[model samples]
Target chain A: MKNKKPELVTTAATLEEVERVFEAGADAVTLGHERYALRQPGHFELEQIKEAQQIARKHGGRVYAVMNALMHHDEVGELAGYLEQLAPHVDAVVFGDPSVLMTARQVAPELPLHWNTETTSTNYRTVNFWAGKGASRAILARELSLEAVLEVKRNTRIEIQVQVHGMTCIFHSKRELVSNYVRHQGKDPEQEIRAAQRRMFLKEDNREDQRYPIFEDRHGTHIMSAEDICMLEHLSSFITGGIDALKIEGILKPLEYIQTVVSIYRKAIDRLAENPHADIDSGWLDELKSIQDPARPLGTGFYFKQQIY
Target chain B: MLTQTVQSTIASPTKRKKPELLAPAGNLEKLKFAVLYGADAVYIGGQKFGLRSKAGNFTYEDMKEGVAFAHAHGAKVFVAANIIAHNEDFEGMEEYFRTLYDIGIDAVIIADPAIVEVCKQAAPHLEIHLSTQASTTNWQAVSFWANEGISRVVLAREVSMEEIRQIKKYTDVEIEAFIHGAMCISYSGRCVLSNHMTNRDANRGGCAQSCRWKYDLFEEAEEEDTETPQIGKTELPMFSEEDDSFTMSSKDLCMIEHIPEMIEAGVDSLKIEGRMKTVHYVATVVNTYRKVIDAYCEDPEGFVFKPEWMDEILKAANRPVTTAFYYGSPTEQDQIFGVPPKMAKYDFAGLVLDYDEKTGIATIEQRNHFAVGSEVEFFGPKRDNFIQKVEELWDEEGNSLTEANRAMQKVKMRVTQPVKPYDIMRKEKK
Candidate 1:
């Protein structure tokens, strides 16, 4: 039997970007609120999230709110109230912390929850565990190989999402590295380090050549890969592997970049749906590569070669 | 007069159960010393499926003997099969659980819920303690795991004292918190830095400790150069004058002085953090904490903090100690920034392998240099430390020796008091 094409999921920062993604043929858009999300610049307020939800619904698309932060105790105390206000405004909520799952189940048991704790959901059993715990969809870890994803799909009925583009997060820490560095330099950490203005890079002492970009916010520090993951050529493998959605992880990116990447993936999925054995055209790959930041390189990432650290 | 009477009544000592003093055992020898020195429970890793993969973990035969030895000493042994299992790991898991159950392991510590379910099926008789790698910081999460049949939950180190008190109020599940040891820069153990950088899966057991590595931060230049920028380009250093430092490495955790508060908070276990330490380390740390916990239990109402316990802890600590996230969020001072060298006040001398009461001599395996006349302190599980000059020394072959300096060298030393096999010996640092 021929496999169905996976839905194209993209991220948006603005109301206009939401419309742009819908026009570019995205089936779903992931939006984050300012207080609960890790991304500082792109997060929307409650009213903006409501508008984005309306725009998504008008275009026959869904909006998944990104609340995937490793919340502290006080932060968790604020979750149920926020989730109560947000339950009616969005289609589903994506989260990483287990505490968030329990809180969401308590406040809004009817809401759909997506489990995407970066590196935790690597196998079918983990997916099954989360699915049994009330998560409707589980995003597989980025470190998994194609065969591993297929194995997860073979074992479970829960929907799975895989990242198809954008820079991958290599490290996540609760310690605010940039603020601590500012304090180490004899400056006031609060005054010197502004979350929205912070842009830092770190390189190993031994390997001075490769540098990874780091983002710090109220939540914590997130270090991303030097090269963005571009898996345009591997869409068929993911689609046939029974992946339910293909995610493009650049909510803070430019609107033009979002539209371009979304359009390219939309065409690729359409091509694959028409002909299961068809390969992504070379022209589409070049178009997808053109939207990436010039400073960051592009690679196939762990999709082709497994990282061994 | 009425207010004074009420205050005195509140200050009176009340009976409370002693919290478990749990220590880490990287090997069988460390396990024995930890149990003997004062640990109520010792957590050890088997040959596979544990976080400390580099440690000299116990084999099945060694684990059986270690459990027997710990039980004989009235201490419990919890085996760590706590790695986040992958698809390939599930093949031998049933056999592993069966072996652990057959060997009489008190409980199995796990991080993955799938593994918890596996244990429920494979070894229904065994208890399952949730590892801190689960990052459980709230009461609802604890309640969730408790409903899932988890007997205990190791609260994440980031949880505050107030939060712990509330969690205890909300749930009946046993709560374990880390009282001493190294801290992860990430939340719990959910980090991929080692995996992405070195290809070693931190979740699977091969953590390269990338957080401890020194890194330099730089800001990207705003203006583009006339020359085309290349990928992986080496930019000029932003803050070059500053020393290369471990921006992410945290200070070691020590809560020896806060024993009364922890006990009052209803903590079920106080866990020590090292599984890759020496037998001397296990013995010293366990003994010191045991004394502190016992003293607090004996007089909780009149408890006074002791400075000597801090001094004793410094003898075993290689890094600066901080009460990490216990009071609240850690500040800049709690983190170790610059790559400074560690300072220790004492050096491990040796372990007493056997004692011959007839000759009034103890057979020792030397770890550091100790001469015939040097003053060394001998301490054991049930005995107070007594200083004695090494008046007589002999090799295993019975030849007279003036000094023992070689590593793992067997030597005999005459002592005034009887010594057991796991008794530790140490000398002040020169």
Candidate 2:
């Protein structure tokens, strides 16, 4: 518990967006590809990250490095060393790989790191399990509504970070389509044709369809792209609730998605500056639905134990 | 017994008792057509829980009435309520189970283990067929479910036939193999790509099928720049780094020639996977296999498969047919999932218009070409009664017609004798 502070952390892959999130009132910025990978190798080298850290520090915002993707052990060790060199400038590192966390602890024992949600840190047992692994905080599953989140936080010592607003991932874990993309491309004539049989998918400028679906058979590709996740209406209640970190997810969403989402969420958060009320003003819900969400359906999330309807 | 039905009918010719020709019936008309064409037992989904969401899934009212209708004709109906459920979704199941129980539907095919537990609690008398979504790939998995009181288990298509024999040995569970239909790229229908890429979960029946979509990636080229630089003697790409990688997709599943081998594996039931498909696909594919399975059953020793039947199987709107993982072991070469042939020889337009009892007249509405010389198969009532011969054809005006070619072509037909309503009329494609 970094002094038991309520840190409004917004995750982003780009520095410019991180700056925008801070301007919108983020307490800290967690960097990694939140479904958006960094295009340049290692995404950005240590020097580039150091520059981003300086920008974040200027606004009194902390920088948290995120290594969410599946990484090789050696590469993780190398990054751990690089991260150690950047330790004096950065805050905690959000991590999942056992090796990466071990190396981070070995290299810079003082740096704080939260266990990434890839570890499926849901129950108190799991949260405490990761805590034993040296994780100070745990990101709760997006599908667990408000009440569920509070239950876990109450039971576990690790602080809770809930996805406040962003794209909801139904493909939570397991890498089938991506693996197919990486493995089956180029050579086989059969695979080339099947890819053509698939439907089209566009997420933040990334589009591909293997005519044949990567998962379920011939009924085309079974997929659902719902709207973005927006919790504006439920914010006051969530803040009053046990959530420690309010997260806005979109490293790959457009600049407009990043900016508008940050601004709206910022206003909603500020609305609760005095007493946190549970009432969700209808206008906030409307504004959220009006936004262009390329992801699947948006949910108020299973956060509130109280299903208002 | 039923001699006039066997040799003169069916695909190849079976040496032993013919495997039941299980066919799909999405609607009442298709159900009638299926039974008349010698379907041993028919499988369908009532509106609630079946694999094919787009199917004319059965409603409660439809199931109650449909079950009675199927039973009147001396056939069986297995209702599908295979939707996967989470804890919160288990509220109204008591009534759902009782409703299915009262309807007299032969059995309910279930997917989720939770739902199976629910069914056991709610409807103790009801029989259960475990849906393919259970992904029973091993003998242990099959026997485990069987111990839980599953009457039949639809084996995952990925399992090899060798495993089937092994599974059969360990458990008394009736194994149902998908004799034909679409292929799943993910292992055992549990891909989150649907829920992840889209909020649709394939396991829960609301799969938006995200795997079928095409995505482009930059493939790391073979000739890495000598500068494919080792930053710290590591080969992995750095995070946040962009690389141009390419992607590919998987193909559909089809197995027509390997029926003999699959039958040899001791499957109690053979399943065909096209609930969302049209009636024409059902009739054509069912009739083709019906003939082949019968041939194999008739002459266990003296049977040679006719090559023309393979050509007949391809006439369906199919992707490239692979034997699937049915042989001793599936080789990499056995995996054939490419683009489907752009053209189909048959469109399976519509059902036979009607049938005359005395004159044995069956009317046909053509979805494809039916020539005087071209053989049209009459899949008649009960197993082993489907007939293949184009001795004659009559037009709508009752004039004996030679050829009827167009979309929705109707013709009056005079069969040898005794044709009943609900008999399917399909012409062999090749």
Candidate 3:
């Protein structure tokens, strides 16, 4: 019997990059309209999503629309209309808020639901609970250890997705912190605020080594990890352990970064699926190193070290 | 005489169903004080499976006594077992649920669905209130939880007043929202800054509160830029010396003025969020909010926001207050920016252990230093607050003393007015 390998999921930076990532080797590309999505790589209107869907169909790839914003009343009121328009264009919807689940069930019953409640999707019972509610997959939190991830996969009936490579969100605030800080400094926010600019980072007074990248957008401020998580070496354990999809977060990266990461992870997943006992490939690490930002270090990220404060 | 008048006025129930005043109780003592002070319900952390691992959590024995005390006073006790559980944390969880149910806990505030499953299967009769850690900000999510058999849903602090009203309109499930407490800059349970910075897992229990730590901003160098600015190497410091160092700290939430708005929004419970606070804090906050809630409920049309309530609460408030996310998105003003705690105008002097009305002498257990000449105010749940000067003082041994400086020392002080046991005595700060 042939082994079942987890699908390669990449966040498409643009509608044009959707086909590029699918060509590079992604089974699915996740993107969405910025109004409904939080910290996405790029925004896509319904027409653009339809275009991406056509492109996905040609390459036999799937498209997942991220509608994972913690919905307020206004967003909740407008979600049904957006989902109704978006229903036909995407294969599934990735959501963190349960409001999206209820809305999707009513408006687009056929589309699959991928539960991705950033930090709280820690245990199997919660994942299974969402699975019982018709979620096809659970996106495990980046904070989970490898052992915990396997345990969740072992117990759950639905597909489990884990981030394989890219910047992990360490903090998300609904407040416009940078703009507010600029205003507090008696400067014009339009000129001083680094809205979505990846160049700015925060260094704790006590910790001089680490510089945490920060950005502000319509959803609010998001602090990215100083280290991007590279799970290429651990791809065997996840794919062999029965994780359904591996998500590569392309939120702050360029199209080339996404391409390199997807291809490397894809090759590694294939190699491991073909031979479970294969030796670690130094060449794959070398390819990923080509695009690795020296300033933004890469680590295994909670896979080995317990995240303590 | 004042107690009788206050009691008689509230004896007649309000026409509208007023929201329950819920308070946090870190231990059995805080629980009793919370119940006595006017909290309709008190949420407590047990010895296991709770997020505040450092808090003095209640033992099963403590739970029984606390539950009994609350229930005896017509108040409810809810256990907060709201940790986002890992696989190992599930060990003994079923037994824990059964034990909580056996203890007659009113409900359990839980965030993890898996733990909720274990709880339901083990103790089906145990009521569940979804924790704000789940971040349920919309009506459909509330309804979804309702469909799942949750009795109540504590709306996320990020939720707005208008969103709350809309949620209540759609679902019959009880809505609980925070009216007072420290605000997390990140959405509750969504941050891993502590985890990434330190080895502690914030969701399970240990939160280093790395957000409250001071951080200096640095600009990243462009690609191919060899001269990347190193920490302390740049001539121009990112922030001026006078700028707030605690960049991410939010002003604490105090909704004393918004009692009517909360009640009108159809909130079933107004939660005060400080489980790790002192008994004095629990009493002061609960007492003030209880009076305000009762006043508004008794006469919604004639209800007026009282400045006195704000003044009373400031004695317990550690930080400046803001109506976070309720009025609108909190701006720069809502951030604390390294300011010190607001200086209190008063200090908790003592608790009235026994009051002799005929002799007008009160036996007190001292909390802070107070002298015989100190001007003190006596207040309690039943009676209106009254000020009097301490004319004379004696030790527990009946020896005359000029001052009560020892912590928890029993002192006898002559008072100007009749006092009751459990009455709080506060001295004005000089």
Best-matching candidate per DockQ? 3
The CAPRI class of candidate 2 is incorrect
| Candidate 1 lDDT over residue span B1-430, tens digit each | 9999678657764746799999999988889889888999999998888888889888999999999999998999998888877777788888899989999999999998899988899999999999999888788789889998999999988888888999999899999999998888787667888877787888888889887887877766543553433223334444557544536888899998888889999999999999998777788899999988887886777677778778777778879988988886676788887765566767789889999989889999999999989999888765777889999899999999999989999999898899988788899887
TM-score of chain B of each: 0.89, 0.76, 0.92
Note the Cα lDDT for every prediction shown. Answer: 0.83, 0.60, 0.86
**Residue-by-residue lDDT tens digits, candidate 2, A99-186:** 4566677788888878764313435555665686688988865545566677777777777788787644433212234433433333
Scoring model 1 with DockQ, what do you get?
0.56
A182-261 in candidate 3: lDDT tens per residue?
Answer: 67777676775544265578888887777687888888889989888998888888877988898888876778778878
After best superposition, candidate 2 residue A151: deviation in angstroms? 10
- Provide TM-scores for the models: 0.93, 0.56, 0.95
Candidate 2 lDDT score at position B426: 64
Rank order by DockQ, top first?
3, 1, 2
Rank candidates, lDDT, best first: 3, 1, 2
Residue pairs with backbone overlap in model 1: A308-B199, A308-B200, A309-B198, A309-B199, A309-B200
DockQ of all candidates, in order?
0.56, 0.06, 0.62
Cα deviation in Å at residue B409, candidate 3? 2.2
